[model samples]
Target chain A: MIRALISRIKQGYRTYPFPKKEPVLPERFNGRPVLNHDKCDNCRACEKACPTGAITSQDNKVCIDMGKCLFCGDCTSACPKGVIEFSKDYRLAANIRKDLLVSDKEIKLAQAIDKQSRRIFGRSLKLRQVSAGGCNACEADTNVLTTLTFDLGRFGIQFVASPRHADGILVTGPVTENMRLALKKTYDAIPSPKFVIAVGACAISGGPYIGHTETSNGANGIVPVDLYIPGCPPHPYTILDGLVTFLGRR
Target chain B: MSRQLISIYNNKSTDIGAVPNLPIDDFRETVINSVNTGRRIAAFFGLPHDNDSLKLIIVLADDHQSILHLASTCVKEKYPSLTPDCPQAHWFEREIAEQFGIRPEGHPWLKPIRFHHSYTNNDVWNRSANETILPCVTDFFRVEGSEIHEVAVGPVHAGIIEPGHFRFQCNGENVLHLEISLGYQHRGIERQMTTAPQNRLIHYMETAAGDTTIGHTMAHCYIFEGLASCSAAARAQVLRGIALELERLANHTGDLGALAGDVGYLPTSSFCGRIRGDFLNMTAILCGNRFGRNFMRPGGTAYDIEKSHIDDLRKRLNAALKDVTNAANCLWSTPSVLGRFEDTGILNKQICSQLGIVGPPARACGFDRDCRYNFPSGIFQFKQMPVATWDSGDVFARAYVRWLEIQHSVAFILDLLDSIPAGNIQNKISAMSPCKIAVSLVEGWRGEICHVAVTDNSGKLARYKIVDPSFHNWMGLAVALRNQQISDFPLCNKSFNLSYCGHDL
Candidate 1:
């Protein structure tokens, strides 16, 4: 008991103060990508280099879909004039689907829920996470929010085991065929006036496994997603940011 | 008589024509004989052949000799099952039968491993084309008697973990048998591997098992490099090695913490959970993502350590290592933690060997099987890390082995960071040669991650097989539950911590 107490003291408080304060992210961390169309020589190198076909030339202009992007930086490496670069701004969540498509424009971030919805979920948001076909990275990072460092409980967002106890459903993965029914069943189990948040690239646009026959691509068609958190597997802070913003906590 | 299996080295590409395609009888006999002599089957799967035939290829690892033996045999529809003679081939044979329509005759418990449509015209289970196939909807082995009740849990578990079903036949508190039916997490990764765009292959491999990003990606990178006949530079090899160890450190620490949490021990659980994030953050510092996704590429790593950050990296690593030491020591010193862990779930060495389990679980059974020591490649070729083992083959042994590995991994990382070679991190990858086969084995934090890529006449991927450590170890988890308390499932499960999607893939 003494040893445990001493060790706890040595550990100290680990929860980071986010929203109230800026989170410390690594210099190398690739978050929201910026595209400089003016610098593009119309070479279309990045479009070819993109692994998930996230970058495309529409009317000879480059557009990147965060939902499809893995933030792999292959475009940045393939570009000649440095037309593409990922900024360390990790706020990449959005409420609307079209808002995720960025082409030399600042993305419209996730908006707060409506007045009545926020009134209900703003103070205490209980979410049930369903890893339909998640590779476990998204699941792990999402679960990290419950840890001492993230302390998602402080933000009033807890991942409940039963959908009956949740105000929303947090879905991850590409929604494989076998899991499609289960995901729909889970969403149906959550009482009405509940919302759905799709976490990670897989949950939004199938990520890398997009065109495969086994997966339904993402959760969009299966259940109506209210929020989309983007990343191959979004950082824990990114997930928390989405939750807080959607609940109108900030 | 000619040799039935062709011996090959790790990360070395062999000509497709060079691998012996023996008769089915000889192939089965050779595989059974080799496995009986202690050679582990690393990968066994089938590929579509000309006309109506299917070709079965098997890669056997001779750990002691540090060599891989490969052979192939063409089967029209069914082949004599090796699982009857060699128990290790149970899962592999079932997987082959599911992928292609080839039946392993006389095999026990034959069922759909992934519940997917067969690549060929035949269906082993004879379901119609439009039939709705669901995962975990199968006949389970039941003990019918008074007080022989059954408990079924999950395709969607109660936790934030991946989906899989567990069926336990319990007589009161004691479990008679635990049948784990998985396929819910399958996304048809192996099918996608054969047809996905070349640029997207690495991304698929990175997520093959999300937690095992570095391990699977490194294995694929090695396979790609081997096929292209290009190797990563000395510095890149060292960097890859460091990233792999960092992955090991992060995961092993997290497992120990989770094990503590399972037993209701709070101190080590909370501390190690945060410490696991610390290790992940260090990886983020090295590259970008906490999971090390974008860090790996085909020829070499995507990010390189800058000279300016070396000192800071060392400082953080040392601090995290120190924190982990204290956390693990607390776990060990606590009598309650030890009491719950000591013999909760015991898997004997013979059972582990028969099931062909690898990684820490195998090591806990004193099997002495580690890819780093047995099949050295990349940075491991220059410096080897000792294989950590324990004789108890229980939950405590699994946890203690991880603790031992965490220490060794930290020491290995520190040594590499101190003497990081000065050279280019990448080399220009040449076009892959046609009609070639290459095998890459990486010691992922979970265990041995095997990736085998076979290229066609056009240098396109014909068949790419990924054998995650979980593939071999899931059965180990099932067998361990025999005669154990049903309530202790979570603790034992965490001790193994097998991957669901990796196996489903």
Candidate 2:
């Protein structure tokens, strides 16, 4: 125990100063994307290359749904004209599903929830994470949120074991056919005035497994999702920022 | 050496014509005899051939000779089951029956491995086509007595984890039998792989089992490269090797910590958790994704590591290695942790070999089966990490073997960082040859991951089989649970933390 304490003392602090201070992310880390229309021609290369239909071009207008975008950067690489590039800005959470759309109009980041939601779940939010068909990358990042670096507990967000204890449910995976019933049961088990936060491209959209027929497209038809946090598996910081965006808004 | 089976090289595509079609009895005898004679059956599956007949293809790996034996036989309606003789054939046979609706005659304990409608019109188990095959609602092997009790868990677990059901027939805390029911996470991956190597193929490979992104992706790429008769550049192979080792380091470290967590050893658990993230961050340094999703492409790696990147990786790896060593050594150094781990859920080597367990679980039982050493592919062919093993086959053995491998992996990665060759990152991959089968085996962190792809006449995938390490080890977990204390199930489970989706697929 003394050796452990000594080791701990030597290790020092591991938590990052997020929101209060900017994070020094890895050099190659992919976060939020920025689109440049001037470089884009009518070429549908990006649309063709996109695994999920996250990047869609219609009527000479291109839009990227942040909920569906996995941030895999295939669209950026597929575009011969170099139209799309990702920025390090990862604060891409939204309370409303529509707020996640990055279209020709404007990039709509995640806004705060309504006054009623804030008044109820603003102080302490307990989440029951259900991995319907998640590949566990999302699950891993979600788990990472609890670590000292992210410290989600500082914000009064905790992942409880049971749905009865949760204010909302964080759903991952593509909502496979087999898990559809279980997900519904889990959602139903949670009391009224609850929300579901669909994480990752798989939960928001079916991701690469979209057309596979095994997955239920995504979590859309199963339950009412309040927030959409997207990534192939979103970064830990991204998940933290999403939670902060939802719960921190006054 | 065998006359009936046509021998082929690993990662080399064999011509459909070269694989001889034998009689059912002869095919069964060949597979049975070969398995009895020490060679393990790498893959066995039914692919449609010869105008609607189910053509059974068998891949046997002669680890010592580094040769893979391939043979096939056309069977209609039913064929003699080799599972009664060869234990490893049980899962593969059950999978074949589930997928193709084929009846394996005289098979013991045959049931749906993955509950689904068969590709064919005939239903093997004879459930109505329109009815829903409920997951985890199967006939579980029962142990009924005056004092016997049953414990059923998950498909919906308490923790933030994957879904799978476990049924334990217990006699007051002692587990009589453990029946694991999976398929909840199945996304028809093999069915999806039939039309693969597409723009999105790599992503699918990476997500097949999320934790095993590098292992699965590398194996799929090997299958692609093999059929196309292309080898990745030496630099690409080295990068892949580094990625694989780093993945190994991360997972093994995580597992060791998880073992600590299960034992309620908080310090090592907390420290190893952070160190695991450090290793993941190192992988993210290479590719932009922490999971190494885009790192692996068909012909070669999607991303390249620069000198500066290599230097950075070396620094981080060194720091993480120190932290991991400090944290993991606590498991062995502290007597309390060892007390909980040692001789708890012991699986004998004879049972493990009979059941055909792979990866660290097999190594823990002293099987000496590390694919990196035995079946060397890519960078492993040039450089090797020795087989790490322990004789106990207990939780301590499993945890200890991982710590040993983690050290070896860190050393191997550090050494490779210094000496990785410089060349073109990728070889030009042309279209694949038609009517060919190729196998790629990688010793993933979990164990042997075998990916077999059979291309059609038009060079499109007709069939693809992915046998994840979990597919081999889940049953072993069940076998290990026999006569063990039921409360220790979680720790025993953490020791062999098999992938549900990998097995479900």
Candidate 3:
């Protein structure tokens, strides 16, 4: 017991003061990607190098779909004129799917739910996390929020085990066909006035597994997603930001 | 009289014709004989040979000699089952029967592994092509007694975990049998690897087992390099090694915390949880992604550590290790935590060997079966880290072995970071040689991660097989549950902490 106490003291208070103070992200962390269309020569090198077809030249404009991007920075390397580079802006979440298409303009970030829904769930939001076919990276990062460093409970947000007790569902995966029925069943089990948040590139736009017969693209057609958080697997801060912002607490 | 198998080293490519081609009967006999002589079955899978035949390939590892043996046979429909004679071939045979439309006749248990349609038009179970297949909806092993009750858990579990179904037959509190039925997380990764766009191949490999991103991607990179008949430079190899060990350190630390959490020990659980993130953050310092995505390429690592970053990594690692030490020591020093861990879910060494388990669970059973030690590749070929083992084969042993590995991995990373050689971080990989087969093994935190690649006549990837450690270790968890208390399921499950999608894929 003494050792535990001593160790607890040595560990100290390690939680980040996000929103109040900017968190320390790594120097190399690539959160949101920016495409410089002025420098692009329509070489199509980025389109070819993209593993998920996230980069494209549409209407004579180069656009990167953050929902489909793995945040791999391959497009940046393929671009000869420095047309593409990922910025350290971690705020990559949206209420609508089309907003995730970053084409030089800033992304209209996620907004809080409607007045009535916010009034009901703004405080003490209980979520049921469903991983349809996630690679566990999304699941792990989302799960990290409950740790001391993130302490999600302080914001009255808790991940409940049963959907019956949840105000919403936060899903991660490409939504494989095998899990389609199960995911639907889970979403249905939650009470009415419930919302769904799709986390990760897989859940938002199927990530790299898009257009596969085995997967249903993502949570789009399976369930109506209230928020979209994009990354190969979004970082913990991104997830927390999405959650609190959707709840009107951020 | 002919050679039964061709010998090859890890991460080495060989001519397809050099592998011995035997008849199905000889192939079965040779595989059984090799297992009897204490060889391990590394990978066994079937690929389409022609419209009518399926070619089965087996890669056996002679760990004592650090050699890999390969052989193949073409079977039109059926092959004699190797599971009856060699228990290690059980899962592989079941997987082959599922993937290809071949029947492994006389097998004790023949059931669908991933609940997906067979690769060929021929259906082994004679299920119609149009009918949609559902997972874990089949008949399971039954124990008939009025007192024996069955408990069914889900594809959607209570926790934030991957999907899988678990059915337990219990006589009151004691479990008689625990059958695990998975495939809910199947995204057809293996199928995609064969047909996906070239650029997407590495992305699929990165998520093959997402938590082991570095490990699985390292295996794919080695396979690609082998097919190209090139190797990563010494500096790149060392960087890859550092990333792999960091992955190991992060996972082991997390597992230890999870094991403690399962036992309701909060102090260590809480501390280790945050520490796990710290280790992951350190990984982000090297690569942009915490899971090390986009850090590995075909020839070498995509990113190289700067000198200042190396010092930063060393300092952070030391700091995290110190905290983890205190957190882990709480597990050992606490009698109540040890009580729940020791003598719980005991899987003896014989069952572990028979089941062909790998990783910490196998090491916990006193088998020094680490791929890094037995099948050296990359930086492992230059430097050595002793295999950590524990003999109890219980949950305590599993947790203890992870702790030992954590210490060793930290030391390895620190030592390597201090002396990272100066060289190029990547090599330009040229066109791969046609009609060649290559095998790459990486000791992922869970266990041995095996990737076998076969290039066709046009230098396209003909077949790619990934054998995640969870594939071999899941059965061990089921067997461990036998005669154990039903309430201890979470504790035992956390100790093994096998991957659902890795197995399903």
Indicate which candidate wins on lDDT: 1
Chain B TM-score of candidate number 1: 0.99
Model 1 chain B lowest lDDT segment of ten: B1-10
Q: Write the per-residue lDDT of candidate 3 for residues B208-284, one digit (tens) a residue.
A: 77999999999999999999999887889999999999999999999999998999989888999999999999889
Give the Å error, residue B166, model 3. Answer: 0.4
- Model 2 chain B weakest lDDT span, ten residues long: B192-201
lDDT of 1 by residue, B289-370 (tens): 8999888787888888897667777898899988999999998999999999998799988989989999999999998899
The interface root-mean-square deviations, each candidate in sequence, come to 0.9, 1.5, 0.8
Q: List the residue pairs that clash in candidate 3.
A: none
Clashing pairs in 1: none
Candidate 3 TM-score, C-alpha based: 0.99
Q: For all candidates listed, what's the TM-score of chain B alone?
A: 0.99, 0.98, 0.99
- Off-target runs (Cα >4 Å) in candidate 2 are none
| Model 3 misplaced stretches (Cα beyond 4 Å) | none
TM-score of each: 0.99, 0.98, 0.99
Cα DockQ of the candidate 1 complex = 0.85
Residue-level lDDT of model 2, residues B1-505, one tens digit each, is 3668888777888888788889888888888888888888888899988666999999888877888898899988788888889998999889999998889987898889878888888788898888888776778999989999999998888777889999999999899999998888888888877764377777888898999999999999999999999888888999999999889888888888788888899888878878888999999899878888788888888788998999999999989988888887777878989999999989988889878789999999988888898889888888877889999999999999999999899999999999988777878898999988899999999999999999999999899889999998999999988999999999999999999888886
* TM-score of candidate 1 versus the correct structure, residues matched by position: 0.99
